[model samples]
Target: MVGRAEFVSRFGGVFEHSPFIAERAFDAGDVREPMTAGTVHAALTKHFRAASQDERLGVLRAHPDLAGKLAIAGGLTEDSRKEQAGAGLDRLSPNEHARFTELNAAYVEKNGFPFIIAVKGLTKDDILRSFETRINHNVQDEFATATEQVEKIALLRLTAILPES
Candidate 1:
């Protein structure tokens, strides 16, 4: 296995802009396990739980909105671009794109942070439904829910990177 520095570099941005998640996982993982995505995901979960509210919010904010402005501007990170495309977000019909933009605006206006979801295997319809549902939650509950989605997204990204061992 590679040393800690390489491990961190490879996995750091797995959680959007949060390199600290990978660093903490590297520090916490079993010396016996092969540092597979699952193990790092477990370790990262622990660190995420221990993080302050602001730190959690920061990582959530780091994620781009699904098929939102960044995608239009072609500014998303390659990983995000691909993940969104996996669910047909990239080729959205014009009406669907407009709906997403309207919902995204409403969600962010309500929650200060962008809506967060692990849009791996879901359709644009599923994402829109989730956005409609989550937008109604009170701030505290939505904050907790958004962080949970961040953890799930991190695990999914890690899984994408590591081959099964």
Candidate 2:
């Protein structure tokens, strides 16, 4: 176990290392401690501090199209990926998968980036509906949405990183 000074230094390092995460870490001041192992807030604050928005979104943007891509490395936590996979979209019926493919393609074509959403606690239906709903957002609107999603994701991650005592 880390001593308080070491923990504080390391914990602060989590913020200094990544701007996106640092922003979130600052918001989670109540839980920012090395002792907060296993809590979602700490994990997110640490992870976000170390990752870029693109990297974080890449993790949140799980899809067959990105399955074989290496660019998404360092994008998301292992737990988040597992949660998203279990969300059942990967098991969508053939027709549904095809529709999703089309939508994914169109979204990428228009935005120059993949559609991103945090799938941690959302159902498959909600995930699909979110795709449809968010597709209509303009670039500026979508950017805001993405940031908001990131914050929400950070909160969820924090909960996991630091379970309530």
Candidate 3:
């Protein structure tokens, strides 16, 4: 069994700065051994599912828009910076960057939150295309889509951080 601090350290950033998810997981039961990527991901997703609509919105909002201001300001987390870079966000041409900026604004204006996508293994072109398509969804559907994207991000992060068995 692990202590609360250690549990948080391991699982906190799985949800992109959302330590409360880890805390909730630890409180939901004793922190058992052999917490694999799947187990930790399920723990985190349980809390995400239990969150109120407003809380889910906050979690979705915690994410930086792809190639958006946070990346420009260097305010994204180390993991986020690397993930974004991996998605070709860090090497954007001027025109692509402008297109992203425009899409970000339009998406947020329509959805009331940043567009959430798990950028790992995704090309910028894929993300841009998804943005165009996902923006067409109604607000309620968009909310569901954003929440699902957050869960996907958490699973990928968990897979990276969980100790190899």
lDDT of each: 0.83, 0.54, 0.87
Per-residue alpha-carbon lDDT of candidate 2 for residues 1-165, written as tens digits (9 for 90 to 100): 444444344433222123344344445453433545445344554555366767655543532232212223434335445555667654567676667778778877766566666676677788778889988989777766765665565555445544454
| Predicted structure with the largest lDDT when compared to the true one | 3
The digit string of per-residue lDDT tens for model 3 on 1-165 reads 788899998788878778888898899883567888887777779988997888888888888888989999999988889999999999999999999999999999988899889898999999989988998999999998889889988888877888534
Among the numbered candidates, top TM-score falls to 3
Q: Write the per-residue lDDT of candidate 1 for residues 1-165, one digit (tens) a residue.
A: 667798778878888988897787677653225767787777778887788888888888898988999999999988899989998899999999988888888888888888888899898889889988888899888888988888888888878887545
Please report how far candidate 2 places residue 18 from its true position, in Å.
Answer: 6.6
Cα TM-score per model: 0.91, 0.58, 0.95
Better of 1 and 2 by lDDT: 1
RMSD of each: 1.8, 6.5, 1.3
Ranking by lDDT: 3, 1, 2
Report lDDT (Cα) of residue 96, candidate 1.
94
The lDDT, on a scale of 0 to 1, for candidate 2 is: 0.54
Cα lDDT of model 1 overall? 0.83
Q: Write the number of the candidate with greater TM-score, choosing between 1 and 2.
A: 1
Sorted on TM-score, best first, the list reads 3, 1, 2
**lDDT of model 1 at residue 152?**
88
